[model samples]
Target: MRRALPLPLGLLAALGTPLPSLAAPSVELGQVLITDEAQDELIDAGERLRETPGASNLVDMQRVGQGRVASNQDVLAYQPGVFAQSAGNDGIKLSIRGSGINRAPGAHGSGVYTMFDGLPLTGPGGTPYELFEPLWLSRAELLRGANGFDQGSLALGGAINYVTHTGYDAAPLQVRYEAGSRGYQRRHVSSGQVLGNLDYYVALTDAEYDGYQKHSSGSAKGFAANVGYRFNPNLETRFYLRYRETENELAGRLTKAQIKHHPRAANAAYLARDDSRPQPGSTWVGNKTTFFLDDDSRLEAGLVYHDFPMDLREGPMRLKVAYTDVSGTLNYLRRDTLFGHQSKTTLGWRTTKHLPNSGASQFVRNGDEFGPRSRDFSYQGSDTVLHAGNDLELAPDLWLTTGLAMIYTRRESAVSYPADGGKVSLHDWDYAPRLGLRYDIAPQLQVYGNLSRSVEPPHPWSLIWSSTVATQPIELENQTATTLELGARGDSVLGRWDLAWYYAQVRHELLAVEIVAGLPAKEANASPTVHQGIEAGLDSTLWERPGNGKLSLRQAYTFSDFHYRDDDRFGDNRLPGIPMHYYQGELRYDWPSGFYAGVNTQIASKVQVDYANSYHADAYALLGARLGWDSPKQDWQTWLDLRNLTDKRYAATVTPGYDDAGQDVARSTPGEGFAAYLGVSYSLR
Candidate 1:
C-alpha cells in the first residue's frame, strides 16, 4: 500500500520553509520506497542532510521504463550544468563545470574522476575510460566540489560513482529485451535471492547497434556477479566481479551535406585526406575485489587491462592496478597506469569509401607510419593519495567536519622511434592538497562549504614522441585549481530543497601551444582561469489521496559562468561547449491499478562552438512522457515511452573554421523525434 506525502508548495509553505529558487514543482507526497542502503545513510526526512561522508543518491528503477539510452551519454543528460557532446553520433565526451573540453579520441587527461562500485575506472594518470556501455547501473551518484573529500584524489570537476544492482534484492529471475532507433537491439537478464546469512546477484547484458552514421556498428556483451555474507550485526563481507567484451566498426562522423542527405550514413566521405575505416576496435577487461570491515570502513582494490589491434592508429596498450582504503577517519589510494610491450601496425585504407567524416577532420593524422618497423616505447605513472578527517559535534544541532589530503604523483615516459634507436626518457613529480567541512543549522536546514585544491599531471603525449618534435624533449605541464563551494539543504513543508554556489580559481591551465616557429606544438600551461556557478534543486510530493499513491515532482536548475583569465585569443571566453542555463524536471503519478504516467523535460541554453566563439548552437528543449500498467497479482509490467514528444529539428554539433570561415561546417546529429517504445518484464521464481 502507498503512504501519504506532504503537499509540494502548500505543505512546504505551511511548515515555514524557505523554498529555493525552484524552476518547477516539487515531488508529491507518499510512501517513499527507499532502499536499505539509502535508509542507513540518511538520518531522516526531517533531519539535517549531510551528503559527504556516506552520501549517495538512487535513481528509482521503477520510474525508468524500457526506453533505450542510445549511448552512455544519456545517463546524466538531465544533470544541471552537465553537457554531453558527441564528436560524431557514437562517441561522447562529458563537460562538467568546463572540464574535459579538450578530451578527444585516444586523448589522455581528465579533470574529473570516474569509478564503478568502489574501484577507479580512470587510469593512474587520470586518463578517462571510454563509456563502454550502460547495462547494469542500479544507481548513480555524482559527488561534486568539496563533497568528495572522503574519497581522496586530485578531483577538479568531481567524481561519478555507478553502482550496479545485485541479485540478493533483485527478482529471483528477470529478463528483458528491447530494440530502438538505427538498428539497435539489446537483451538483459538478472537474478538474486537470499539464503540464511548469504545473498547473491548475477546479471548478463548484450547490445548491438548500427549507429546513425556509416561504419558505426557497435556490439557489446557483459556479465557481472556479486555475493554478500553477513557474519553478524556488526560486520558484512561482499565480493563483486565483472567482465565485458566489445567489437565496434568505425564509420566515423559526417559533414553537414552528408547528414542532410542520409541521416544514418556512416560511410559518407567528408574529409578528403582522412581515413577512419582502419578496422578500428579495442578489447578491455576489468576485475575488482572489495571487503567491508564495518559501516564506515572499506578496503577495495582492482585491476584493468586493455588491448588495441588497430589498422592505422598507433598509441599505447594499457595496464592498471589500484588499491583503496576508506575508513571513517582516514582514506588512502595507490594507483598506476603502465604501457605494456607490443609493436605492430596495420595497413591504411586506400579508398575514398574509408575517408574519415567530421566537421574538422584536419586534426586527425592522415599519413601512416611507413618505415616504423619495430619500436619500443614505455610510459608509466603512479599516484599516491592520503586523506584524514574528523567529525566534531559543535552544538546539539550543528556539526563540523574537517579534512585534509596530500597527493604525490610521479610520471616517466621513455621512447625509441625505431628498432634499437637511442632511447629518451622524461620524468616529473606533482603534489596537491585538499580540505572541506559541513554544518547543520535549524531543525531541518544545513549549510556546507569547502575550499580545496586539485591538479592534472602531464600526459606521455606531451613528452615529445611525434616526428614533428623527434629531438625536442617537451616539459611536463601541470594545472592547479582552488575551489570554493557553499550549499544549504533541508526537508520542510515545501519538501526537500538544496541550493549551492561554487567558484574556482585556476592557475596554469594546461593547453597545447605552438612554442617555436619551425616546430609543431608542446603541452604548456597557457594561462589562468575562473569558473563560477549557482545551482538549486527540489524534490517533493505535490499531493496524495489514500490508496492512489501520490503525484511527485523533481527539478533542478543551474546557471554557470565559465571563462579563462590571461592569454590571448578570446580571453575570458565563455568556455566553449558549456551551457549557461540548464534545467530538468519530472512529474509522476502512480495508482493502485498499476497504471502510471509521467512527464520529463530537459532544456539547454545557447552554447558557443569550439574556442573560436564566433558560432553557437541554438537553445533547445526536449519533453517526453511514459505511460504504463502493471498487474497487482502477477509479476508482470509493461510500458510505452514517448520520447521527444514535440518534433524539433536541431543540430547537435557545429564547428566553424577559425576566423569565421565560409563553410558552415555543421554536423548536426538528429535528436530522436517522437518515438514510442513498448517493453515488458517478468519474473520466474
Candidate 2:
C-alpha cells in the first residue's frame, strides 16, 4: 500500500518549487521557507522533462470518445498517409506508405508496426495485426518514419504508440451504447481507478453490423484490461491484455459485369471464398498479453506475446520488447499453419470392379480406396525471426540507434499421394543502423534529422507447390533502404505546427505484382526504388471569447511520389495504391456551458492499383458532424455523432485483374453513410 500525499502538496510538488525572493540588503527576510516537499516536486519535474524530448500529438480523451473508429486503422485514417479498410468491425486492413495493400496468399508481412504501452502487438504472419481497441487507451502518439526509434523495435514506415491510462488522480466509470445505419450497433464499458500506489483501466466492446453487401453481416467482440502499480515515485509495473473474436460471411472480388449488374448484389460463390475466411462459416481469434516495468523514469522494459488463430488460415506467434529508456529491445516471432482433411466412403472398389456397376459408379470408383484419387492432405510451416537493438544517447542533442535482425524460415508441405512431396527452409539476415539529431535553435524551436535502414521478410505465399515444378523458397534477399529526413516543430499563433521533408532510396525492394486472378506470378526483389515526400500539420484555436465560446481548427496534409527506378515488368511505374496527395481538416465550436459542434472532413486522391498501372481507384471524400454537451458543474455527459452525412457511394477495396468474361474483376465496397450514434456517460470523482 502507498500513502496518498495531501492534495495541494501532491500537485504542487509535481510541478516544482518557487525560488526564494531576495530581501533588501539591510533587512534580509528571516530564513526563506523551503519545505522538504518542495524538493521532491523539483525532482519530479526534472525527470519528466528529461524523459520525453520531441513534439507529440495528444488527442483529447473526450474527442476520441466521440469518434466511432471501428478499428485501430480508423484511429490512423485521419492522419496523413494512414488509412484502414474494414469490410466491417474486426475485419480490418491497414496501409501506411502503401504497404500491405497487395497481400498475396501465404505471405506474412505488413510494413507498419503497432505497440501498446511500448509492447509490440504485431504478429509473425504480419498481415493480421491485432486490431487494438482504442477504448482501453488513454492516448496515442505517432512517431512517423525513423523518428520512432524510441519505440525500441525495428520498423521502416513508422510507429504507433498507445499509452494506457495510469497513475494517481480520480476514478471514473463510463458506459456507452450506440446504434446506427447498416444495422451497426455497439456497446462499450470502461472504468479507471487510482488506489493507493496502483492505477489501472479496463474496457470491453461488442459490435455487430449488417454490412452493405449481402451475406456480409458480422459481429466483433473484444475485451481489454490494464493494471499498473507505482512502487514509490521511482518504480512502476503494468500489465496489458486484449482478446478479440469475430465472425464474418462476406463477399469478395467481383468481375466488372457483376458490378455493372448490381453494385450491391450478393455473389454467393465469391462470398464463400473470402480470403480471410476460406470456408463459408468461419471465425478468427486474436489475443495479446504484455507486461512492462518502469524504473526511475530513465529505464523501461517490456515483454509481449501475441497469438492469432483462425478456423481456416495459418496462426502466428509473436513476441517483442517494445519499451526502453536506456537500452533498446529484442524481438522474436514464429508463425505456422496446419490443417486436417478426411475422406470416407461406404462401398469398396472391389464391388465396383466385379459387379460392372453403372457408368456413374465406374467413373466414381476409378481410383480407389473408396474412390479413384480420393485424397486428403495438409501442409505446415514455420517462420522464425529474432530482432535486437538499442537507442544510445551519445550526446545531449545527438543520438544513435542501431540493431540487427535475423530470420530463419522453413516449410514442409505434403499431399497424401507420395507423388507430391516438398520441403523448403531458408535463412535471412538484416542489419539496421539509425542515427538522429535534434539541435535546439531556440527555447521554442528545434531542428531534427535522421537516417536509418530497414527490411521486409518474405511471405509464405512465395513458396511454390506444383508437383511438376521444382518449387523453391524464394531466395531471401534482404530488402534494405536508406532514409534522410529533416523537420521543424514549434508552437505559435498557428497553434502547434510540424513540417518535414524526406527522401528515401531502397535496394532490393519488395514490390507486389499481380500475375493473374487469385494467384501470384512470382516473388522478386526489384531494381532500386525511391520515395520522396513532404508532410505538414497544424492544430489551434482561431478565436475565443472569455467565458463564452471558442472556435478551433486542425489540419494535416501529405504529398509524395513513390516509384520504382526502372523495371521491365512495371517500368518506372509509380508504386500502386499510394496516393500522391491526401488531407484532413476539422472545425469546431465550443461554448462555455460545454455545448459543442464540429465538422470533420477527409480526402484522398486517385491511386493506381497494379504494377502495370492499368487499374485505378477513384478519389473520395467523407464528412462527419458531432454535437455534445459536457457540463463543468455536472458529472454526466451526452453526445451525438453522424458520419458520412451525404450517404455518398464509395469504394473501399479494389483488386487488379480481368474476369473470365474479359472484364475487370475489381470490386469496391461503399463507405457507410448517414450513420448516427447517441450515448450518455457519467463519472464519480
Candidate 3:
C-alpha cells in the first residue's frame, strides 16, 4: 500500500460511510505541534465551532465543576439537542429543536434566544429566569438552527451564549460549598485579577431548598461582575454586572396516580391556595467594544440594560409585573481573498426595546387579603435585526456558507384598566435565509449540510395572556420554520462523534394548552406542524492504563417527532409535550491522582399528556452517581453527588392539556427522589 493516491469527491464520500465514529489524530517528532490552547477558552471555542455549517454546542464550566452545579438543570446536563427539565425550583423546561414545546415551568421562557456576555438577554416579555446564575459560567455557546446566523439569532431555539469570568479564566481567589437532599444549601464567593491592561471578575451566589413537592420551597440570590480594558494592540473594552433574587413555592400539578403513589404529593388546590412566587429583583447591565480594522478587519459594539419584576402570588391572581429593556449591537468582521479562495465575512445589527413602563398590575386575592386594582395593562415591544454572512474556500477541504436576515417587529397591547379597555397595535416585516455545506473529510472527518429559515413572535404577555375575552387582544400569528439539515463529525477507533438529522416545516405552530385548571398555559396558533429530529453524540475512551487509571464514556440521544398536519380535531395526533425518546449516559473513572468516578443515566419516552391523544406520562428511568477530587495543582475541589438512585417514580415535566377528555388530569412534574450532594471548592492560583 506504499502507493496510495487519488481521493476527493469529498474524500470519496467519506470512504463510503458505514458509520464508524461517524463513518471514519496526533502529532509528534516536531518542535511545532499545537492543536489548541490560547489559555484554553474551551479549546478556543472548539476551534471556533469547527467553522460551523450547522449545529453546534460547547459548554464547559471546567467539566461542569465535577458535579452538582445546581440549576439550568445542572448546566444542561448531557446536552445533545437539549431538553433541560426541573420544575422544582430554578425553573427549567428549556427545549431546542421542538423549540418551546408547550411552554410552562416558571414565568417566561419561549423559543430560545438568550445571551449574556455576548449581549442581549431576550426581551419583549420572555426568557426571564432570575438572572440565570449557574455559578456565573465561563462557557456555554450553542448555535443550532440556522447556525444562529452570526449571532443575530432568528429564534426557533438558536443561540445561547452565557460566557462570564474574565481575567483570562479567573482564579485569584474563590470559595464554595453545597449540601443536599430535600433541604439543600449552597453558597459561593469569588474574585479574579490581572493588572497591566486591566481585567477583573467577581461572583457571589446563594441558595436554599426544602422541596421535593409539598409546598416546594425555594430561595436564591446572586451577583456577578466583570471589567476589562486593553486600549492598545487594536483596542478593546468590556463591562457588565448582574443582580438577582428569587423565591418560589408552588407545587400544583401531579397525577399519574399522583406520580405512581403519592410521589411527594401536594396539590389539593395547592393546599387550599397557598401558592407563591416572589421576585423583587433582577437586573443586568452591559457594554462591549472592540476595533481593529487592520489585520483583516474587525469592529464590534454592544450595550444592554434590563430589569425584570414579577410577584404573582400564584392563583387567585395578584399579579404585579413591570419590565424594562434596551439593547443594541453592531458587528463586522472580514478576512478576504475571495476569487482565489479563502474568505470569511459577517455583518450584523441587533435591537430590542420595551420601556415606557412595560406592563401589568392586576390584583384580587382572598384569604391572604388583597383587593383593589383589578386590571391595568401596558406592554409594548420591538425587535430589529439585519444580518449578512459568508464563508468560502470552496474546494480543497470544501466550505461554503451564506446567509441573510432582515426582521423588524413591534407589538403593543393596552388596556388602561376598566375603561373601554382595548388596544392592540402591530407592525411586522420578516425574512431569513441561509445555505450551507462543509467537508473536511480528513483531519478526523467532518461533513455537513443545511438549509434554513426561522421566525417567532407573540409575547408582549402573549397578547393579554392568551386571551379568550378578557379585555380583547388576541390575534397571534408569526411562528415559522423551514429547516433541513444533515451532519457528521468524527474521530475513529470509537472515540468522539456527533451526528445529526433534522426536518421541519412548521407554519404557525405556537401551541401551549391547559385550558383551565388553576391557570396559566394558553398560547395558540397551530395548523401545520411537523418537526423531525435525531441528534447523537458520544465521547469515549474506553480504557487506558499508562499511569494507572482511565475509562470514560459519554452519550446523548434525542429523537422527537412533533405532529399534526391534518387537524380539525386532532387527526394525526402526537404533538403534546416532548419525549419521543430521549437518553443520556455517563460512565467514567479517571485517576492519575486527581481522582474521579461516575455513573449516570436518564431515559424517557411516554409523554403525551393530551391534545386528544388522551393522556400519557409513564416511561422513565434515572440513576446517578459521582465522586470527585481534583488537586493536581488545580488548587482544590471536591464532589459527591447522587440523585434518584433507584427511587425512580418519574415525570420530570409536562405542562400540556387541551382536551383531557379521558381525564387522569393534574399535569405532572414529579421526578426527584433519592438525592444526595456535597461539594467544596477553593482556589488561589
What lDDT does the true structure give each of the candidates? 0.52, 0.51, 0.81
Residues 144-225, candidate 3, lDDT per residue (tens digit)?
7778779899887788888888877777788989898988898989887878899888898999998998888989988898
Q: Which stretches in model 2 have alpha-carbon errors above 4 Å?
A: 1-61, 104-109, 166-172, 231-235, 254-263, 266-268, 272-299, 313-420, 460-473, 518-524, 655-663
RMSD of candidate 1 to true structure, Å: 10.9
lDDT of model 1 at position 157: 67
Which residue pairs clash in candidate 3? Answer: 20-23
Per-model clash counts, in order, read 22, 8, 1
Decide which is better by lDDT, 1 or 2. 1
Error of 3 at 560 (Å): 27
TM-score of each: 0.76, 0.73, 0.34
Alpha-carbon shift of residue 324 in model 2 (angstroms): 25
CA lDDT, candidate 1, residue 3: 22
TM-score of 3: 0.34
What does candidate 1 score on TM?
0.76
Ranking by lDDT: 3, 1, 2
Candidate 2 lDDT over 1-685, as tens digits, reads 1122222112112111222221110110111122233234333432322223222233323356654656664555445445556644454555555455554322344666566665655433344533456666644556556545444434556666665554332236667776777787888877777777767677778887787666667777777777777676655667766677666654554444454455565554444434233212211222222223232113344554444444331111111111101112332221122122111111100000001110110111211112243222233333333444443444454434344444443333333332443444444444556655555444444556767766565543344322334332334355667888876655554454555677888787655554544433355676888877766665556898898888877676767667777766566777664556777777888887778889988776766666666656667788988888875744666778887788655555553332123335453444554678776766555
The list of candidate 1 runs beyond 4 A from truth reads: 1-62, 85-91, 105-109, 125-132, 229-237, 251-376, 419-435, 462-473, 511-524, 630-634, 653-663, 666-670
